[model samples]
Target: KEIMQWIDSENSKAKVQSSIHNFTDMCWKKCVTKDITSNMLDTTESNCMTNCLQRFLDTNINVVKLIQAAQK
Candidate 1:
């Protein structure tokens, strides 16, 4: 049982990492329209990425809440 729990924890971590990677790729494509001239993001790109991440988190939270409610 402990080994199974550890495996599940690892799988969840991997899935979270994969989701973050995919979200970063999507936000980059949507926000970055110009060539990479600087090491840091400008205000527009930064805001866009922030908003994208916020929306993603919000959606995930709502889904989780809904799932929990349904399960209960």
Candidate 2:
């Protein structure tokens, strides 16, 4: 039982970490428009990043609800 509990805990942590990294990558791609040479983000990039993050969170919440409903 103890070993099983440990495995479950690790699995949960890994899942959360994976989700965070995925969202970070998705948001970065959507928001960061400047080329490597520019080295600076303009107002547009900043706004895009913020909007991307918000939209990502909204999508996650909505999906979770849909999944829960389907389970029922």
Candidate 3:
């Protein structure tokens, strides 16, 4: 039971991390818009990526809260 629970937890973590990576890749493409082969991202690019990730997580949290409230 414990091993199965641990595997499930790890699988969930991996899925979330994979989703975040995919989202970051998308956000990067949106911000870059060209020469994705470029190595280093500029300050604006970096900031945009950060904001994109933060807002994505924030939106998810807000939605979860709204769903919980509706359920209650």
lDDT over C-alpha atoms for residue 24 of model 1: 95
For residue 44, what is the lDDT in candidate 2?
83
lDDT digits (tens) for residues 1-72 of candidate 2: 999999999999999999888877888887775575576667787788778878888998999999999999
Per lDDT, what order, best first? 1, 3, 2
lDDT of each: 0.96, 0.85, 0.88
What is the C-alpha lDDT profile of model 3 across 1-72, one tens digit per residue? 999999999999999999988998988877776566668998888898888888888998999999999999
Q: How far is candidate 3 from the true structure (C-alpha RMSD, Å)?
A: 2.3
Q: In terms of lDDT, which candidate is stronger, 1 or 2?
A: 1
**Which pairs, if any, clash in model 3?**
none
Candidate No. with top lDDT: 1
Better of 1 and 2 by TM-score: 1
Model 2 lDDT-worst window of ten: 32-41
Candidate 3 — which residues are off by over 4 angstroms? 34-37
> Which residue pairs collide in model 1, if any?
none
How far does residue 29 in candidate 2 sit from its true spot (Å)? 0.4
